[model samples]
Target: MGSKLGAAVAAVVLALPLLVGAGVAGIGSALFGGSGTSSLNCTPDGTTTGTVPGMTAEQMINAATIVAVGKQMGVPEPGWVVAIAAALQESKLRNLHYGDRDSLGLFQQRPSMGWGSPQQITTPTYAATKFFEHLTATPNWQTMSVNDAAQTVQGSGFPHAYAQHEDKARAVVAAVSGVRCQPTMAGTGDCNNIQAPNPAAMTAINYACGQRGLPYVWGGNGPLNGDAGFDCSGLTKAAYDAAGISLPRTAHTQYNAGPRVPDGSLLPGDLVFYGPPSKIRHVGLYLGNGKMLNAPTFGQPVQIDNYRYPGDDYAGATRPAEHHR
Candidate 1:
């Protein structure tokens, strides 16, 4: 870890041309839409440059993990933009086992402030998950500007620093995920829906949204049927059922029913899982842009939330076949 961290620092210490042929600089414009003003771009081989150059392979790998974990947690691409930007600013994408005042890992999360223990905070995946969980919980996070959203989560002494890294972060996410970061509603107070590619997916997402504000009841099946409310899996099952797809009762079984969607490739109406491996205990329907339709535990009503709650584990995801139907 120390040597890898050193390699990252040494590589970044040099200057590289921001404009690489058909890589980060070229492809990035297409993914983000060519306003012809943005400086982001990516190489076909996946090396990225623009905002900050000399990104090492190890750093890129960590950036990819952060994006993937955010997706697994139901974080939208914008959320990923903020996360990567912050990581670049805080640690330069290096998962340092050390930092000022007990700060550690990719985001420089602090243990003294209750971020987590040194071990948990230092683990790149765990640190990124913790960061996104806090970020998504911030009110109107999806609507806040990249810097504002990052500051809301990190509360860094240097609040303005994150802005400098957004372009590079977007570039990194593009290179690593094989998906370009799209335009976001950040800072605009419009967490608007991303259009579903097909009718069945649209229908299922709409059905789930229609049930918002309903109470959560354990083992409760459906509001349309006889049952009063719904549990986590119950809500997902019922929503898909309305879209004409059949799903098993338990979260684990439902997870096994469909082709798995990689976290970075999630589409609207996909099933998002939470818990441990095949033992997944909860499920929700992905609604694109980092939110999900959930029937949370006892006291909470059916609503949209950042897919992974604090301390809520991310299992995996599956895309229902109905979406293609």
Candidate 2:
């Protein structure tokens, strides 16, 4: 699992898109609804009940493609839920043209990672078909939770993230296919149930907490750089660096630098970022208890502060893998 996840990380550099980033634009008729590549009897008379409210037309179109592809492939309804959940986590139901490394399309699958060519993956039908192919190939995917099934194919660092979108995935699938599925899938429940970080993650956070009294420097030296104090990204950079992980320099880049962690499923050593996905400016290491350790601006010393300070931008959080970058 670790080796596959490491390979996934190395292969898909910016593959982890922001969970709440600005929506991608300009999906025409081809990718939307069904492309009619294969015959499926899932033509909806109208928008089904339980469709996700506030979903963009692009999201609905991608959802339709996912369901259509699954049906044409003879994948079960549960498989539809798994596919929807994985797409939700990977590309937010958009057939994107760009992703980390060579990743492209709805699942952010990388040609370099052996999924398919850029042309094939960028097409909604092709992308969803490829995803279902890998998914059904997994043993007992029907019995697995959405997360387990998705993680088996995605190999994302945050394997538990797929479960977080189960309800919405179920809704999206139900809406598109007109098959109402219960929110809970077979494998597991909410990812927030994961209470404690593993020992390695604990070690990384503790190392950062130990540096609480260090002074804040703009681009000052981190422990990795062997400097006196830390900057925002530098603090997290130093902590994960101690854990033998390499991270990007800025807050925005660092946001997409590692595995995509859902909002409430954050672990101890996770890096939290501020601002919307389009404009991530600040960052910190979560210390639990609604507090994070960060270096705030020039002249402010490194210390523990409220995770959400008044007027804080509050973007999202990401967790680094336990292995070397």
Off by over 4 Å in 1: 1-52, 179-325
Tens-place lDDT digits, model 2, residues 1-325: 1233223322221222111000111122222111111123232244355246766656866776677556645578898898889998889988888888788888999989876678767867667767877787798887877889999989997889999999988877765664221111011111222112333444456567677678888787565577878888888877777777788888889987767776565545678898899878899887665767788888788887778778778888887843421
lDDT of 1 at 40: 20
* lDDT of candidate 1 over 216-280, digit per residue (tens): 99998876778888899888888778768888988999988878976566656688998887588
TM-score of each: 0.44, 0.43
> Which clashing pairs does model 2 show?
14-100, 15-100, 145-187
For model 1 the TM-score comes to 0.44
